[model samples]
Target: MILPITIYGHPVLRKVAKDIDKDYPELEKFKEDMWQTMYFSDGVGLAAPQVGKSIRMFVIDCSNFADEEPELEGFKKMFVNAKITERTGEEWSMSEGCLSIPGLNEDITRPEHIKIEYYDENWEFHEDEYSGFAARVIQHEYDHLEGILFTDHCAPIKKRLLKGKLTAISKGNFKAKYRFTLAK
Candidate 1:
């Protein structure tokens, strides 16, 4: 199933997500839905909050960048109840966009490396470290679990300039190929 992504201004996007255990209802099915929704929406990453679920879960697949980064050829994983234990290395800027905030991409700066502990879709625990593009993608999705958006990291002036566009998005005035739910 392709879940409808919650658009900007959706209340759920602004709330911190809660952790879920192995007994989470239909966990496997939900994870499959998330993957379907993300792929359908042309997103490399998607978080639970973006799909109107307040749970600490997100999925990422960077295989599309395999040509550019061979290491990411098979980098696909689901993160549950993830916690970033550390962020190190110099910061770099890269353009980032979210499925929830479609048609908007901003140059966001983030650390180059991160250490995170999380459970896979099978509910198996694992702690791992990532760098470069992988780290950036992880951080972007992680922000969603913390009630933060990539635009929030933009310069003050950039935000002010984006106010009109963001308001339009909140009002369902933007175009997106995937299904979305606007704030009521």
Candidate 2:
């Protein structure tokens, strides 16, 4: 579906999301749509707020580009209504960029390992312990479900520098001339 992504400063992006209730008949379909949207937009993760939904949901698939041989199929992963069940003591810093905050990247510190519980595409419960970059991605996407953006963790000087630009971006004062696309 490649739904429009809400940019920085959008009120919905700041609004705390409600948990997904069990009765939503279209939840399965929404998951599929989110996957399609992420693939078409070439994003590693996409949250409900980015797609104009205020529900606590997001999709992630980090299985691309592992093989240069091209003989194997890539893997895909999805996390629905995910919550960090447990986190370890060790922490690491990584540079993260968001689909919503285009052209902005920053280093953020997070737990190096995490245990998460969430439902998969089929709405079945699953739990797994992840470490390294996988853990970092999970923490990043999980924040989106809570109405938290990467900028919220930005350093004070960085925040001050980005303030005006972010405000303009949120107001749509800057027009993106071309959508980012994968090169062949």
In every candidate, how many clashes are there?
0, 0
Q: List the candidates' TM-scores in order.
A: 0.98, 0.84
The digit string of per-residue lDDT tens for model 2 on 125-168 reads: 99989776677777888888888998888789988998987776
- Clashes counted in candidate 2 amount to 0
* Candidates' RMSD to native: 0.7, 5.2
lDDT of 1: 0.95
Model 2 worst lDDT run, 10 consecutive residues:
175-184
The lowest-lDDT stretch of 10 consecutive residues in candidate 1 is 171-180
Question: How does residue 155 of candidate 2 score in lDDT?
Answer: 80
The Cα error of candidate 1 at residue 133, in Å, is 0.5
**Model 2 residue 175 lDDT?**
47
Using lDDT, give the best candidate's number: 1
The CA lDDT of each predicted structure is 0.95, 0.75
